[model samples]
Target chain A: EAGVTQFPSHSVIEKGQTVTLRCDPISGHDNLYWYRRVMGKEIKFLLHFVKESKQDESGMPNNRFLAERTGGTYSTLKVQPAELEDSGVYFCASSREYDLGLSIGAGNTIYFGEGSWLTVV
Target chain B: DQQVKQNSPSLSVQEGRISILNCDYTNSMFDYFLWYKKYPAEGPTFLISISSIKDKNEDGRFTVFLNKSAKHLSLHIVPSQPGDSAVYFCAAGDYTDKLIFGTGTRLQVFP
Candidate 1:
């Protein structure tokens, strides 16, 4: 099976500019998520989408950041008037809905795409 | 405050030896723990996982041990190979919730 794929593996933009990152998850996966890792820090959750509807967006940092999952297929994360602190690696992950009785190991396992590296100057 | 933490920033191990990475979590609600391996410029790959009900889970060459009472977990790789060298991340989550990750530990294996 093909793994999750992300667009524009690396990007550099001036501060206050806008940038959008795209992610195509593995086929048939309904649970998609967005996470970001600042340099030298742990990867932190941004938001999650269960097929088009957002399940949780509590992790979103601020109003400038927006994420959308259109048609329950792929996802996009956009940062408006990006700040220097917005520079980080953004990762997109997907997993099948969990069937608790089945196998927790693989059922809840999430696969990630090669992250999009963003640098704001 | 960081819920999950890998105290060690890096570890070095000789090939054919055992490599053990440790992690600690402050959240007691976390019931599912996972370990992921990541190479530079790539995303994390799931290595192994253990649920709170069990103390130990072993794969072919990898093992995960969870100590619920202490809120600690560890990953052990036997007979380490050079290819196994990478950054290892520890993650924890509640049932079906988003995972919280630790600052990764970089493991280097030399022959």
Candidate 2:
């Protein structure tokens, strides 16, 4: 089975610009999630999608960020007016609806991305 | 609130020795625990998991022990190998539908 796939693998945008990261979860999987790690901080949850419907978005950092899971197949996270603080690895994960074990995608690993490596100059 | 905690930032151990990594949680509602391993530039890979109903779960050379009373859990790797060097993260869930992750502890198995 094809694992989750992310787009642009890496992105570099200037401060004040906008960037959207995409994730295509495993087929037939109903759960999708977004997480990020800023600098030395732990990876933090941003939001979750259970088939197009956002189950919980309490972890979203602020108003500058927005996420959508249209049709429940693919998910997107948009960071606006990007700041230096947003310079970190963004990860996407997905799992089966009833199964708690996340069948992660290869690109969604939380390690490092070559990283969007944004220079908010 | 940081529900899960990994006190050690990094650990160094000799190959063939045992490496014990610890995790503590403050959430009493969490009934499921998991460990994930990550190599540099890679996403985390699921190691093993144990539900609250079981005190322990073992897979190959890795063992996960959960002590519900203390809200503490540990991952023990016996006969540690150099390939086992990576960052380890402990996570918790409650059928709350989402997993909460710890900061992670880096494990370095010295040759």
Candidate 3:
């Protein structure tokens, strides 16, 4: 089975510009998520999508960031008027949603993509 | 504040020896923990995981130990190989299924 795949492995854009990152999750996976790692910081969750509906988006940084998954397929994260601080490695992950009470080990496992490196200058 | 933390920034181990990585979390609600290994230009891959109900879970050469009381967890790799050198991230999960990760520890294994 192919794992999650991200497009434009590396993106460099000027500050105040708009950039969009894309992610194609594994086939049949209902749970998709977005996360990012800034310099000297741990990877942090951005948002999650379950079949086109957002499950959680509390981690979003600000209003300039937007994520969408239409038809429960691929996902896109758009950053408008990007700032320098937004530069980081953005990762997309997917998992087969199972009962949370069943087995915590494998049931809730999430597979990650290679990540897209975005640099704002 | 960071909920999960891997205090050590890096660790060096000789091949054929054991490599132990440590992690501590501040949140008591975190019931599940996982370890991920990442290589340059690649994404993180799941190494092993352990639930709060159990103290230890072993998989071949990898093992994860969770101490609920201390809010600490660890990953142990036996007979470490050169290929095992990479950045290892410790993550904690709650009922929401969101994995909160640590800053990661870079492990280098020498032959």
Per-model TM values vs. the true structure: 0.96, 0.90, 0.96
Q: What's the TM for chain B in candidate 3?
A: 0.98
| Order of quality (DockQ) | 3, 1, 2
Residue-wise lDDT of candidate 2 within A22-116, one digit each (tens)? 88877877878887777767877788888999888989989999999888788888889898888878778777653352322121222212223
Better structure of 1 and 3 per lDDT:
3
lDDT against true structure, model 1: 0.90
Strongest candidate by DockQ: 3
Residues B1-111, model 1: lDDT tens digits: 999999999999999999999999999888788899999989999888887778999999999999988999999999899999999999888755688999999999999
Pairs that collide, model 3: none
Clashes of each: 0, 1, 0
Q: Is the docking of candidate 2 incorrect, acceptable, medium or high quality?
A: acceptable
**What DockQ results for candidate 1?**
0.59
How far off is each candidate at the interface, as Cα RMSD in Å?
2.4, 5.5, 1.8
lDDT by residue (tens digit), candidate 3, A1-121: 8999999899999999999999999999998999999895889999999989999999999999999999999999999989999999999999887433246655458889999999999
Pairs with steric clashes in candidate 2: A109-B43
Answer with 1 or 2, whichever has the higher TM-score: 1
Please identify model 1 stretches exceeding 4 Å from their true place: A99-103
Stretches of candidate 2 off by over 4 Å are: A98-119
Chain B TM-score, all predictions listed: 0.97, 0.98, 0.98
List candidate 3 segments past 4 Å from native. Answer: A98-101, A106-108
